[model samples]
Target: MDTVTHTFFGLTLYAAVKKEGWSRKEKTAFFVTAVGGSQIPDIDVISSWWDTAGRYQMWHRGLTHSVFLVPIWAALFSAISWLFWKVKGWKLYGLGVLAVLIHDTSDLFNAWGTGYLEPFSTQRITFGTIPIVDLTLWAIMLGGLLYAKLRKISRPHRVYKLVWLLMACHFIAQSAQGYALYEQHAGRYEQFALSAGFVPGQFQMIGKKNGVVEISNATAFTEPKLQVELKSQESADLDKLFAANPKAKTLYEWSPFVVLVDNEKQIGLYDPRFYRNGQSFLFEAIEKDLKQGK
Candidate 1:
């Protein structure tokens, strides 16, 4: 999930739980710690230096995104936050951990999912169930925040409660969307097995890439592509695609990104074409790989 969203959700959750035993100071501490903890997952970006050799070295959504990390990361952040809490440290630590974990959970709803197990297993998770930016959820959550901070209404008012409820609904709806997509391809997983790859897991962002249905596997630094063909009915009137790539088309459906490069011999596809990112560097890399016959 977006950091901003995590922060907002964390803050709202903190506020909602304030009535328990946490004071305003403790709530504030929890919110801050959660925000920081939520960002902890991305610290793996530093591993790009290793990607030069092996893409799996420091996969993005790996162990850092794990549920197990929740306690560890939260405890880590809580310890840092505790240094400043100046009181019963456990409250801040507990609240901080829960809030941060919520932030991680919320992020699983987006396309750029995280890997909860980096040092362990390199797996990414995402549920296209809710778009990275869901307007309705945004409106309700942002509106609620605006009202809480702008309006002079009591914090415990019904309106504030509604915001939390809406956010919760969004999370559930997003999770369901992911599950639905997974089930949609459950039986067909074998069809696309050889051509490309299937995540074979839940909530990973699946997309069309360079004319092939691909799953953005964070396990690969560049996100190796996957190719999955859609059943005729699975596509939007795929009969028309019969003549497209004949061989590939037999399996593919109506995919806009799945275009034939020049419709020539065996070699097609060139979107954003390598030359677009700086021909010299691109050529150098391509040349280097070619020299090695990779």
Candidate 2:
């Protein structure tokens, strides 16, 4: 999820707390715990400043977003709350854990996955059942907020809880549709990935077989519309490219599949899942003259 969505998650979590008899200080402490924990994992973004090797792709959502680090973050938040507000208990720690856990898990549903397991495993776990910026989720949250204000509800926490429930249902529905589309086309390709479109019930299905990659727009209630086909130069010798640009190697490894470009002018590779508008944003290329030391 994007930064805005994550912040909203933190806000919703805070709002869902039933603090009927809580003190002002206690409420503030819990608020910090919820919102802070939701964003702490993204601290890995700072690694980009020192990323001379182009490993930022691998490091951005790397170990910091790992499940192993969740407890550590929670403990830190809990200690901070205790130090500042004199509020110390399992409740603070537990909410912190929940907030951080939500951040890590939510990242798994997008095309740009996270290193959820980290040191234990470097696999990028992604379902691609949700877009990076989901308007549906935003709408649900906004609607909940509006309803609470208009009705002047005494227990707004209940409204937020309902918002959470609705969001979960949306996720499940999108995942189910994506899964069905994947299964329908699984046999046609050796490797495949799903990227949920910005619109609900829609997806971009990417499949690779042999050296050919097929990208299609699909939905559960409609036939998949063929978008474009990409042919990968599977036999391309990438030794020079990898040697000159280590990020190219990282990109190759981090992506589920890549379309290798080997031609007279240049040698490069790009992730097919992000292909768009006759090019891919994730493309990495090097001139053949550079490769030949010209």
Candidate 3:
């Protein structure tokens, strides 16, 4: 999920809490715990400034987003709350855990996956069942806010709780449809990935077989329409490319599969999952002459 979605998750979590008769200081402490924990995992973005080896691709959502770091982050947030607000309790720690957990888990459902297991495993766990920016979720949250305001309810936390429930249902529905589409096309390819489209109930199916990659638009209620076919140069030697452009090596490791491009002019590879507009945004290339020091 994107930054906006994560922030909203924090806000919704805060709103869902029952704060009846709570002091303003206690409320502020909880708010900080919720929102800060939600946004802290993305601190890995700073690695880019020191990324001389072009390994930012692997480091951005890497160890910081790991499940192992959740408790550490929660403890830090809890301690910070105690220091600033003088509010000390397990409730703050628990809310921090929930906020961080939501951040890490929500990322798994998108195309840009996270290193959930981290040191235990380096796999990018992605379900791709939800878009990075889910408008439906935003709508649900917005609607909840409107309903609470218009109804002038004495207890507004109930409204936010309902919002969370609706959001969960949306997630389950999207994942179910994505799974069905995956099963529907599983036999056609040796390897596959699903990228949920902007609109709900739609997906981009990327499947690779032998050295050929097929990208298609698919939905549960409709036949998958062929989008494009990409051929990977499986036999190409990437030693020079990796040596010349280290980012290419990281990209190669980060992606589940790559479409290799080796020709007279240059050698490179790109993730087919992000293919669009006649090119892939994740592509990394190096000129043959540059590699040869010409």
Candidate 4:
């Protein structure tokens, strides 16, 4: 999820709390607890400055986003809130933990996955069922906000809680549909990647098998339609590429799946899931010496 969405999650979590009978200072502390924890995991972005070894690709959503780090972030935020507002309670710590959990878990639904189990495991877990920016979530949250405002409800927090229910339903629906489509063509492809389509229930499914890649659009209610087909030259020598662009090597290792390219003049690899229109931004190449690796 994007920073804005995470920030919204924080705000919504804060709003969903029943803060009645609390002092102004206490409310402020809880507010900081919710919003701060939500954004804190993203602190990994700062590692890019010191990353000269192409580890930034692995660092961006790395250790900081780890599930193991959730309680650590929560306790840190709780301590800060305790010092600043003198509001001491296990509730604050629990809120902080939930906020951070929401941040990390939401990221797993997108194609650009997070290192959720990092420090223990570097696997980038992604369901690729939801877009990085899901308008459906925005709409659901905004609609809840609007209804709460208009309905003269006794407990507006309930509305926000319902919004959470809606968000969960949306995620489950998207994931289930994507899983069905991926299973639909199960034994055919060696690797598969799913990208959420702009329209709900539609997905761009990328499958790679036997050095060939297939890109297609699939809908839960209909059969998949072939969109583009690409060939992957996996046998191409990547030693020169690894020697030239170290980041390319990191990308190759970091990505869940990739498309290898061995054009006439150069050899490279790119993530097929990011293939948009004609090219992929992840494409990394180095000039080829046909005779060297021959």
Candidate 5:
């Protein structure tokens, strides 16, 4: 999920709490715990300032987002809240843990993935069942807020909880549909990657077989539509290119799947899942002529 969505998650969870009998100090403490925990995992981005090996790709969503770090983050946030507000309670710890857990779990659904296991496993786990910026979630949260205000609901907290439930259902449904589509084409392709479209229930599926890549879109209720196709030439040598661009080597190792581009003049690799109309942001290339001199 994106930063805005994560912030909204924190705010929504905090607001969902019943305000009855809660003092201002208690509310402020919980607020910090919620928002801080939600944003804490992304702190790894700061590592870029000190990174010299081009490992920031592997370091951004690295150990900080690990499941093993959840409790540590929660405890750290709780201690900070206690020190700042002098409001000490178990609820603060619990809310902190919940917010951190939500942040890690939600990241797993997007295409960029997360290092949830980190030190234990170097694998980048990703379901790709949800887009980074999901309009569906925004609509659900916004709708809940509007209903709560217009209906004058005495228990708005309950409405927020209901919205969470709806969000879960939405995720499950999207995953199932993507799974089905992947299965339908699995045997025919040697490798495949799935990316959720901006629209709910829509997906972009990329499958590669024998150097040919197929990019298409599908939905649970609609027929799969072919978007574009590209044939990869594997004859181009990549040793020189990889030697020149260490980041390209790292990218090749980090990605679960990739599309190799070798047209003799240049050698490059890109994540096929991110292949847009003509190029991908995740691509790294080096000129073949330059490779010879290095």
Candidate 6:
């Protein structure tokens, strides 16, 4: 899913855990430590994708996104929490571990599919669960969290635990939709490597229409997965891309500027680093080859 969704999920879970009796100062420290751990996996993408090579070899949620790293990563976060917050012993460590778990859980449902076992393999997994951005989910979650911060339970304790219940319900609803979509397309999906959105788990059908596609999660918040129009009905552009590239076999012949999808889902895409590997990707050289690969 999108980073915003992950941030909100982390916020909700981290807030919920503070009910375990930590001081406001300690809670803030815990939050900082936890969010850092949560955001760590995505850090690799900056260098990998934007480097001179433009190599997506370690882009975004790569090996750092592995579940196996949870233990070591949690320990690192815990040590940071202990030092910065002056927290003692196991309390800080426990919180850090929980925070990492929450981060992984958040990714389980969102789009972009996570590489939970990344170190072992680079496979990306998604339940085809939720849209990357869902305004309804955000409104309910962020709004209620803000409301809780504004209202007081009884004066001495300002924390409101009710928000947790709402979060739980929202997660449940999202999972239910995934199951429903699975049930609806079981045969067709299994017949091919297919992916479909599952959040709010509604039974609405989705497919291409005219020059575009539409998606309905039975919720106003969910937007279409991708909207595309064929520049040529015959896919002449694709044919030319394949014909032009010397390393055509290496790059699956996909236009990265187009919609994102795994290599397995589609065939022929260029490795991002192909153009960036050397200085040849420069404007003059690129324009020289635009006729075939653009």
The Cα local distance difference test for each model comes to 0.49, 0.94, 0.93, 0.89, 0.87, 0.50
lDDT of 3 by residue, 1-294 (tens): 999999999999999999999999899999999999999999999999999999999998899999999999999998998899999798889999999999999999998889999989999999989999999999999999999999998999999999999999999999999999988897899889999998999999999999999999999889999999999998877888899999999999998889999888878999998999999999999877866654
**TM-score per candidate, chains pooled:** 0.58, 0.97, 0.97, 0.95, 0.94, 0.63
lDDT of 4 by residue, 1-294 (tens): 999889889989998999888899999999999999899999989988888887788888889999999999999988998788888789999999999999999999998899999888888998889998888888988898889889878899999999999999999999999989878875689988898976778888888889999999888779889998999898887887898888889898888888888877888899888899889988888876778853
lDDT of 6 by residue, 24-64 (tens): 76877667755676666666666644454333533456566
Model 3 deviation from the true structure expressed as Cα RMSD, one decimal place = 1.6
- Candidate structures ordered by TM-score, highest first: 2, 3, 4, 5, 6, 1
After superposition on all C-alphas, the RMSD of every candidate to the true structure, in Å, is 11.8, 1.4, 1.6, 1.8, 1.8, 8.4
Give the residue spans of candidate 2 off by over 4 A. Answer: 290-294
Poorly placed runs, candidate 6 (over 4 Å): 18-25, 49-54, 154-161, 189-294
Off by over 4 Å in 5: 290-294
Q: Give one digit per residue, the lDDT tens place, for model 2 in 1-294.
A: 999999999999999999999999899899999999999999999998888988999998889999999999999998999899999899889999999999999999999999999989999999999999999999999999999999999999999999999999999999999889888987899999999999999999999999999999999889989999999999888898899788899999899989999988888999988899999999998877865654
Q: How far is 269's C-alpha from truth in model 6 (Å)?
A: 5.5
Scored against the true structure, residue 2 in model 1 reaches a CA lDDT of 57
The model with the greatest lDDT is 2
Q: In candidate 1, what are the lDDT values of residues 1-294, reduced to their tens digit?
A: 555665566656655653556577666576677567657766666777655433432255556667777788777776666577743467667766776577667656554455554446445554445545456666777788778778766654466568878778766755554455455543543322111112212233344332344433222123333323221213332333333324234212211123232211222222111112222111110111344432
Compared with the true structure, the alpha-carbon lDDT of candidate 6 equals 0.50
Error of 4 at 50 (Å): 1.3
